[model samples]
Target: MAETDAAPSIALPPRQTDGWQMLAAIERVLEAERDQLALWVPVGFGAGIAGWFALPGPTGWIGLGIAAAGVGLAALLFGGTSRLGRAVTIFALAMLLGLVAIWTKADWVAAPRIDRPKVVALTGIVEAAEPRPATATIRLLIAPDTGNGLPPRVRINVDAEDLPAPPPAGSRVAVRARLLPPAPPMVPGGYDFARVAWFERIGATGRALDPPVIVAPDGGSSLADIRTRLTAHIEASIKDAGEGGIAASFVTGDQGGIPEDDNEALRRAGLAHLLSVSGLHVTAVVGAVMLLTIRLLALSRRLALHAPLPLIAAGAGALAGIGYTLLTGSEVPTVRSCIAALLVLGGIALGREAITLRLVAAGALIVLVFWPEALAGPSFQLSFAAIAALVAFHEHPKVAAFAARRDEGIVLGGARILLMLLASGVVIEAALSPIALFHFHKAGLYGAAANIVAIPLTTFVVMPAEAIALALDLVGLGAPIWWLVGKALGLLLWIAHVVADAPGSVANLPSMPRGAFALMATGGLWIVLWRTRLRRWGVVPLAMGAIWSLLTPPPDILVTGDGRHVAVRDGRDGIAILRDRAGDYVRDVLGEASGVEGEAPALELMPFARCSADLCAVDVSGGGRTIRLLATRSRDFVDIRAMTRACAAADIVVSDRRLPRTCHPRWLKADAPFLRSTGGLAIRIGSGEVESVAEQVGLHPWGSFAAGSR
Candidate 1:
């Protein structure tokens, strides 16, 4: 009876909310925006390529097969069924395509492995010549020479003082040299020089024992000849080596000519991007050409009325981009920029949007498909990050609001542009900071400020001036233009010096973990790609990455790949480097990783250490852990005996020579055999644990070949 009276009011738990509704909302949004979201295909494909590279050895092939099968199954199950099904299918297909791309590129660029170091007479045609401030390096494409088992390409370093002139590109040369496989990372979790070499088809690096003898005169293609002549002319035009080097770099992308100190200055000031041939350079050149073409077409009434002006202008821009790419030697960055420029021009020619996310995606996809290995390189990462960030930021509502304001006058308009430049620079620096940290272990704190001043000057003055000068030089009328370029370069150099000299211009940070970087990158991409308020979620991963990077523990000891240098972390968070001789590269890598600037002093090189002629003993205490380390540079029996005596009481022993059998348990041999296998070793003193570069990277074909042999 009571229930009958109240059959009325059964509330059913007030219709409790379910988590599935939120997911349903997401699905609805994704379905409605499938076309816009499809841009992620190339991104996912690139990620899959990176994954393939990260996989261990032949397991990559297995992973590829699995992905391909999954894609096929997905397509079979959901072909044209629903939006969600299509999205899943697209994802699987993209991953499969990525793996296929990686496999194809790897196979296409594969070179014969070098088994051992050998002194041989090498005869090959020089592909390129990069003259460093301290040495001259020639890139030689082997001509199936008989004596040595050199790979397709080798980089040979000749003493600059002894060899006054480097062999020009396309010149056949003969040289006596000791050829070794490309050097691996200097420390665990460091740069992978071997991987870079593999992708570049450079199988080995060598030091020339004698000056190269030119077997034939330069016989390069017309494009190469022109580029060489242009570079030579620019270098000869400017008297100062630094200025000339900067001019050449801007025009031809030959950075090797710049001095190390100058390069460091640029890096510290965050102007190093200007040295690379990238989107900025290509855009400047293409824009100038397009503007000129449009103006010329406008002058002709018939052409303006009847002809497709935009198409003609776009064609001119495309030609300019092609020329610039060829001038820059078609480096990866240049190629990427050229592709993007061409895509944008093609869109203009077709009456579509000139610049859009699709254009960027297409360019990225092309690079990924052709050179999947570039996904690992800093230049590729930084270039894409900068452009993507710029595009995303400019497309944002806030940026649009700022840009919509009418130009009051030249003064106000200039101010607005300056503000926009500052904003864009900030956005780019923020986007690239994680990548730079992950790769270089450092960030330029004042990058935004430096870029604000540098970008406008470089884009409007330096690049355009250089391009004009290049054109004029073909007609022997480039002297004045060259002077103008030199002036702009001088100003750029001055800006670099001034900015880099500022206190705290460079921020040295320990390397960020790969997982943390991946997390941050995902969030960054989300923020850039998503068109909803949910994009704010990206901040969470970004903050988490920053915290993770700050908290990452620095290695207690860093051993160089060559086994000749060891950096031990001291109690004061300082580094004590133990070495028979100084190595700037090793010092810089260790310093950046440990957050130390410049070089560790001689006293700090082996603090609290007792050293004999060949052996050095040190006790390192830090983070509530003590480690007894004994290092010896000599393989002499006397030094070995001293090392053995010390090893009995030591927790770790690093030696250039093999240790005695008694010391085997605690020994980390830095000999050729040990380094060949391990590349480099980073030891955690407290746990007596080790991280090997070779082991962490696993047994890839390229790295394994070098690691397997002495």
Candidate 2:
């Protein structure tokens, strides 16, 4: 009989009590995996801060400091063989210190205001277009030229000099700009200009001193002008292609041409990423090249051996990808994504059929080294997280089943492709959700569904049309292709618009508290760095969610005015007030936990979410259900009783005048509840009656509309 090899002796610790065993297991992890896991974290942390570092000022210093600390921590953790325990403790301590510094530095917000009276000539590049078309402003990328630092760099925005039309891209010009903060209440419902601009490293904004002048090089080359022309051409090409066309967008990051309505539809359908060229776009181009190269080389073995067809194709495709990134202004996400793809391609060229985490790590190290400040931008954070998640997920057994088995055919049917896209979207969305929610207060719930439908269409139809359009334009026959692209774009736009308008579309979530957000982010990082395994530790976020739910309190006071209803903070927290009267919008700010059983709960649980008193005419009764109310003819009772269905009591008793009415509730007595002041009207509460609180403050309405029956 052939001798059978017995299973290798299992290295087993003697059986012990559950508690001791658990502690031993954890200790083993601390000894074995903790140091390694901690080492990778700095890279993740560094990537997140890279873009911000490039912005100049204390931000750069903070980034540098974090990086230094991280490296030191990694060194201590991984350097010596005998000091592992000490190394782990030191690394943890360093992380705590570094995070505090990073967090404090990021909270340093600048208030940028223009000084038209002291206008000075400045130079910079156009970051993006202002919503208004009257003119555009250029944000300088130099540090001395901006809000902080004295090294001849800064991000000052100069209004474009008045010209017949916009200057072509890359034209360097001098302009006098009086930097100013965006006027308060800048947009109807949008981002805070100052905060967002802060992240972009822009300090002040003003106007051009002269018509943008073209600056020439020592010899005569004005590469900026050439770049300008190309950018404009790309923009126009996409615009001409109609709405939602990714072809022109792929060449330039000007997907705004896709129309917001159409974009929303596509977003709802889960296909909006097609609008931006990212890892998927680079991969698509690479896949196409690989397919073509394999087919072409199969015809002749000599070509493969003598010409090295695979290498040539990979090189060409990579060059194309890099060129694409450059043509599109080399956005942080695209650049990072391109670098990663190239690393993978470079691996392919090396004759290794398998690519590894080492490749991704190399790519990240390269990017962080180059743009240390990029880590501040959402793009870099989300992009890197998505990439890491995909890599980890791909390495897992179940997730691999979802990944493309062969380069030749990932999936065929549109629905199947859609599902894969959805899965990827969900993975990324889930990975980035906490931060996105914390910072943006917006969540794309159906994003996965949207990507499912959109990515395939984009890969197969939209992206190819753009490449074809470019060639056609070169050959002087681009109009037909442009037209075809435009038509398809319109369809995608329509789809996007429809989706955006769907019953449950944009989830305008409430702002996340700092601590909770920190917890969520930490949990997510744990999941991302957890080596493709669903460890029991993954339940940390769910535990947090449960805690958040249990701890959340009800709103303190419900105030209504000018057809508006808002929940006032009743705890030790800073208030982030919404713009207006949409109860749904206000409800979103209170957060989703408030909304239970398809309606906000009427619980007086936690101290934070609780409200003070039933106040205002908007709705104290029936949970202020409907959002409709006619403009106040007078501040007297506005009759929303039918809507509130709070047969017990009305939303609030309104009184425009100081006089009392027998019809008004005895508690509501002709109270002067609304008073006009410089900051605006003060709607007081905490009275036995809704309008009574204002009466106690001696604020009387100057009219006779105070009666509930007015």
Candidate 3:
């Protein structure tokens, strides 16, 4: 070899057409992403879980068969030397694992559900209790006694007046409550409480007929009691309900005490994350502990010289994170943050980079393996997406290089930090907006700006003050710290209010099409996961998704699953409902679905509608088409002859009762039975033609009321 070192004898392949060139390019791209292979596992796994949820009904054996096939395929590919083969095998296995995991979890958590409304006397342990100011009710998680003919768990709310305070968890209690199956979505493409209840093993929900009588008082100091007591202590210390509620939520994750107005304000201001103990809160706790431990240890020179400071600090941080997670009730967000925090600590102990995209992937994978159903929830999606965006933004070559530069002075350094925070906020907002819109149909326009002030205030001032105050309260000397916490929270609340009150601060839109959301999500992931130049192509889909979303037409008419409330879109970008005096819950849901930020006006009040005690006729101008609609104002019967004539002239007819056969609408007949089967209805009309009819409920466990019927 030394005799000539034949200039790396290279064999040139023969030139080929565009097809071969494209294949070669793809292979090159795959090679470039070799280091990123692990990052794709959670994606594939989540896709499988999503597929399982998208199925119309349960298919346990099919999932198992698919997983088995994957195992076999992986085995076959194990012998292959090709990188592509290895990648495919790994992805296939991950997908199958996800499918099997969710299926198994679903089967395991399956429990009997209330088939219909019933009032029964039951005694059970109080697993949890929460206050509901809006409803003037106090909710309790009841763990039924054995052989009660009830599911393992049921939740019922008693009148706030009936009890002095919420019963402590673990207290055995008896109550006569009217139990009903979990409520399905009130509007098309709305939140599904039934599905959530099914997974949590909550068979029924209702209001108590009488107050719960405590059979056995809870005297033991358990974790649940600790949380309850801490919440009570915080609420007692702070006289202001709003501040105290926010403070309690920060420490104990008991958000029940927060007033509805304050909660709405926080959500609109985009500062709502502070109320939830997630990555920010967890990191604050861990970092504070680590800093204190390092400082305290450094004071001891002899011990400091002999001890591994980073490893010791990491261990302390890990412990603090775990304790905080448990204290906060181990919510999905908290659990994910704790998992990520532990991963970071492990990395530190191993002398590796502590934060990276791979860290997010590992945490998500761990959660999916254990609770696969979480993959379908907004909490999981938002949590992981936000973290991944931050990591990816900082990992960019230019950004990382700039961030690594040494600052000449404190002012410059502080400025640099502020700039980075602002930039990170923007990136996070961009990544999370699509998800928020998909789930909630609303996105905060100024969340990034609001976060710049709120996040630092919370992480630095509020959390530390609260933690110290909590510690001092144990010794009855946290008055000053509590004051500081209140002041800091007040500032945060002020910032939120300012941002939320700004005109156009929030973009409320109709529910986005599933296709558009999926496209955006995929594009966002591509941009976050890949480091290659090819990632720029993700913008194409992002743009396409935005266009698709913008093109989606809002429904001209909305009918609740119960047919008790109805809304029709006016020619202007507003909606008018059947009942002008609809309850807050109904009005709010209807408004959001119709892209109206606040209360929608009554159809009778609109110029295009006429209403009476029992009937309402509407003329909706949708896309230059005047859609005639008739709906009942109440369940009271109308003259059959009159109803038939009105319905025959209308494009859509909706009522709470069955309609006569003589009454036929040209477009749709959304009566009680139809609404019951569909859950909710959203109808769009264009140019005198029925454009689309979207139903809220699908063949899912939560919405399938007929299943397990009594």
TM-scores for every candidate against the unseen true structure: 0.91, 0.62, 0.93
TM-score of 1: 0.91
Give model 3 RMSD, 1 decimal.
4.4
Poorly placed runs, candidate 2 (over 4 Å): 1-23, 27-39, 43-165, 168-178, 181-201, 207-227, 234-246, 256-258, 263-272, 289-301, 353-358, 401-422, 531-534, 545-710
Candidate number that wins on lDDT, 1 or 3:
3
The alpha-carbon lDDT assigned to residue 423 of candidate 2 equals: 71
lDDT string, candidate 1, 1-710, tens digits = 34455456656665535755765676787866665687788887887787777666666667665876686576659554656567767777787788788878877888875666888888877776666652355434445364555687888777776555555557778889888877677776688888888878888787889977875464445565566556667888877778888888878887767778788889888889988989888899899999999998899999989998888888899998998899889999999999999998888777787777778888988998888888888998899888888888888888888877794999988899888988888899898888888888887878898888788889888777877877887898988988888887888888899889999887777656777887888888878877667678888988887888787777787777666788877667678787635778777888876767755654235548877767677887655787677777656676456555677777677766666666642545455567667777777766666777876567665776255422
What ranking of all candidate models by lDDT puts the best one first? 3, 1, 2
Q: State the lDDT of candidate 2 residue by residue for 645-678, as single tens digits.
A: 4222432333333423333332322223432111
Candidate 1 whole-model C-alpha lDDT, 0 to 1: 0.77
* Tens-digit lDDT track of model 3 for 1-710: 35865587588877899976776677788899888888999998887787777655555447554765666486566624656666777777777777778878888999999878999998899998877554677889999998789989999988999976777778888999999888777776677788789899999998889877985574676787788778888978887778888989988988887888888878887777778789999999999999999989989998799999878988999999999999889989999999999999999999899999999999999988888878778888889999999999999999998788794799998889889988988898899888888888888888888999898888889888888888898898999898888887778777878888899989888878877887898899889889999789898898889889989888888888778788887767888889877898888888887777766877888887888889888887777677788898776778899988999999889888888989999888878767655667777777333322222233445556332211
Off by over 4 Å in 3: 1-18, 58-80, 133-135, 687-697, 705-710
Assess candidate 2 and give its lDDT.
0.49
